[model samples]
Target: MALLARRVRPDDWKPIGVDALEANAMKVVVSTDNRSVIAGPGAGKTELLAQRAAYLLQTGMAPPPRRILAISFKRDAATNLAARVRQRCHRSHAGRLDSMTFDAFAKGLVDRFGQALPERWRPRPDYELMFPNDTAFRGFLFQDVGTPPKAIGSYADLQAISIKTFERSLLVGSPLPVMGWPDPTVGQWAADRFWQSSLHEGKKTFLSFSMIGRLAELLLRVNPIAREALRLTYSHLFMDEFQDTTQIQYDLVRTIFLGTDAVITAVGDNKQQIMRWAMAMDDPFSAFDADFSGKRTPLYNNYRSSPELVRIQHVLAQALDARAVEPVSKTAATIAGESCAIWDFSSPEIEAQRLARFVAAEMKAHALGPRDFVLLVRQKAVDYAAVLEPAFRAAGIPLRNEAGTVGAVMLQELLAEEASELLVKVLRLAMTKRAGRHWTECQEALGALRGISPEDEAAQAIFARELDAEATQLSADHPEPPASKADARTIVDDVLGFVGRERLIAVHPAYAQGGWFEKVVEAAAVHLHGSSAGAADWTEALDTYEGLYAIPLMTIHKSKGLEYHSVIFVGLDDGAWWSFAGDQVEATAGFFVAFTRAKQRVVFTYCAKRGARTKIATLYGLLSKAGVQTIQIA
Candidate 1:
């Protein structure tokens, strides 16, 4: 059924939840020209995109059957942007916004139009997505003899055959010169070989996200019909976190929408380009301008951070780029005392213990919960977890290492995955005692899963009754919350049995591919086992599962686009941030990102015993210049 368009007057359309947009923001939002919005941290990038989407939809710029496509780097960011637009616009208008991550978008293209791909590049209908390690690549490159090919110089040369190498060579359909490779030809040959091996498994095909992207790009390029169809379907495009876009992704966007009438609005801060290691374009903003002839607009309002914190962030930002403009803070300090501080400790153990104690005391003093605080590291959050987790446990504070892996998946990624979300939602529904928004949402989801329409009140009523009976049975079977790993597994099984795994897979077809549903369930159970400890009861345990009552520990990369009342940066010495010396620009940008995540307080800890401070002396000096206090703990 085609959706009916709701036309709204341009004069009548207004920003939701705000009086009016900033002058520059308003121009960007209403402008029909392709635009590059370079915004610093806390500049309301996502909100601006959401508002712009609402503006376009409400004004009937993208009418019925013509949709707006919004692409974000992260799944959560995509979901948030879609949710905001849904809240601001009418149901029919909001339905036209297709918000998805770059990976998901590319995969969708491949999934729908894969048959258009040449046989050599085509994947099976049920291809398994694989994230191969360096070791696997090395084995594939130099099978068994432990001898390097003439093209491969040494072990160091093998490092050149990374995902970026594939993106540039195999994905782009030709070999491009790679920085560290001996020859582009050799790199292309290796990438092609890897792809062939990945896709040709007997009775089974394997594909990586990069492979899927390449296939998608190929499908669009080779099949003019598919390309034209996409161009005609979307009249407006939104690119969130544009600075992190990779070369292949940029090319994919150009392949589909470059010559079309679609207006592309890219929003990002170059200072937050932390994905360079993953082959993000070096000068994405300039490339976007050159390719799309985009009008550049810079936003200066800091809506997420306090004034003091914003000031501190500017100091670091200026250190990264001498000409950087300071963003004005729209928020005032709500918490009293120092907004930025540096803690110096003599040893790692002392640092961990003192930091734990400090967080515990601060939570009690400020009447804050575990969610109010977060710990950020430069990289390798698991290593930091090994040091900090015990101390936090000793302090009776639960610390969740979001960057750590559950099974083969990262904890944060697993929690955000569809299967995991489904399990959590079902568990929450089962434990519900009263009817409210949560219950209503859960019932709606269940009804949708069962193919029952909301318009059919009689069908909905019957399904709701059956759902209630199932929930009752689940509750009776497990009267108490999960107390152990076994209990968690049992609860998962019970929930799956109650809902019927087959029905869930039928509703969410993606779950049927690659055993993804089972894998997520396994990961969720493992995570529940570790996180449910010390939980008072079912509700408390569920709270922990839902990322409540626990401090979040993640890398600075993972901490992007998120905020907390207070942030603690651990292991600021050279050893933890070894890459800082080689790429100070990105490191400083990352530090700026971490600094801006705190609304009221930012704490930096340096342990003398962990590593020498010689490499990060400049960082320490920058903090000093920012007027941040240095507290030496005895």
Candidate 2:
């Protein structure tokens, strides 16, 4: 039935201010004065936000919203919210709430404000480079790092790295540029730096995202007409995932509503800021607690997940003592507790094989499709990071690696190598503002790699320095005749480099000389330049399997915004150092994040043996060995 047609209980105590609405939603909304919030896993925070938005508009509490800005963390989150708002608008006449990414906001600001710039001071085409597809990014990574990361997984890895570099290089300590209302001060800094750094020496060709954000901001500030237009539009700005909102993006939202009659109702789940790359800041308050100390209350309850899943998460929360978030209030009706499963293996090498068997069995018993579930992992570069990633890929199962979303599509080859994704992660973080170095290092490498496909030996030579060895090793192991793989790498490098060169034109300067994105891309590209022809086309030759194999292999960070029916953790074996597990608090928290993705079940798979010849040490076993035992299923 259509959601609109679904029975709307007037007294429905569903999650409102909090993920668990209960009857306290209206109370929290009233208490907070205007804005309300919801927090927690499976808390239905989005639903609550939607309900509150609908009601505020329906009751004439909010001024007519010409364009209600609904910002979200991920593309999925944005789309999800827009869908809900569209659905809810049927009952209310709240004009329209335009949904967009914070980056998009910054871009919009520049687009609106660019009128002030000299005719020549214009943005290049496709100012925004999409989040690379899992496969495409993987291909780029292989071409970059020469060897793949042991097992690091997730797009966040690259995003986090990129964000860190951006933040670190902000030596002036200026705020990032937002979209709608660009700050002139930030805009000037951006434009001046971009011309000096990126275009200087003609070293780097591609622009970093930080540069783009600042330029967009500059455009907004320079154009007086643009700022006035933004003021005229989007009177009331409601940003979702406000806690995760970056500084620049936040600035734009705040600027547009400055001194306006528009009421800004910032609603979001503060506890879910996992985007370290974007530098996700702590939320001011969860829906349960009032952000305003004077009038604070909480909506503490859950509307999703079974009691089993919720309770386990609760136990972890208590044990970990996570201070950033409030307690997860369980409201699911109790059912039989679903035990967390652990898989024992002799070695990390064997973990993949065993997990494959386990996953295959689950597929058979559950009649699951490739899209039905996923395999969660820690890092994308480390060995055994997501061991099951290759196992599933090699086995012909349609396994969704970390990078593919409807709005965000990656290349197909990225799914082949385990550490391939981290290449992108590392590069994103290390991106420099200077276009020349970034351009010279990255675009040149990508160009050479791209050449391999078109059989351009000269281009292949450029990136061969970096990837030649690894590519040759892979080719040698696989033993391909005449080095056909060499040509493939060139093609991939060319495509990515081509794209990077275009993107390079827009990044802010100052970051060009030294940043993760620049470093990783440069390092990988350089590596390829030195390698033999066989390795030049490594990106195209990476192995792949097709099927809905091990649910989906992803980083724990990626698991935060998703849910599954059952999740199994593998390679949690051996000592902390040897096993392919997240040993640090962040990694452990990532484990917890992965474990909590399930709505009904969770499975922890780790090897039992400590020092088997090939077994990797698992931090989980060591940590649990202190008092808690690693519960093995078989």
Candidate with top lDDT is 1
lDDT of each candidate versus the true structure: 0.80, 0.46
lDDT of 1 by residue, 268-380 (tens): 99888888867688889999999899999999898889998888788888887788898889988887788888888988888889989988999998899988999999888
The 10-residue segment with the lowest total lDDT in model 2: 405-414
lDDT of 2 by residue, 1-634 (tens): 1323123344542323333346655554333244545456666656766766565444444445455566665555665665575456532342355665666566555544544554434544323232333353344333332321335334334333232232324421244333322333232333334334332324333344444565565555666567677777654555666556665554454455555665555655444445534444444444213322223334556555666556666655543444534445454533243345455655655666666665566657767655555665544423444455577666556355544421112322222221223233223213222324433434332442233332355655665454434333433443321243354345335434424533432332221223423433343333333232343232322212222232556656656666776666544434423433332433444555676677655666555453331333334443344333444343
lDDT against true structure, model 2: 0.46
Tell how far residue 341 is off in model 2, in angstroms.
4.2
TM-score of each: 0.88, 0.57
Worst 10 residues of 1 by lDDT: 173-182
Query: C-alpha displacement of 244 in model 2, angstroms?
Result: 2.6
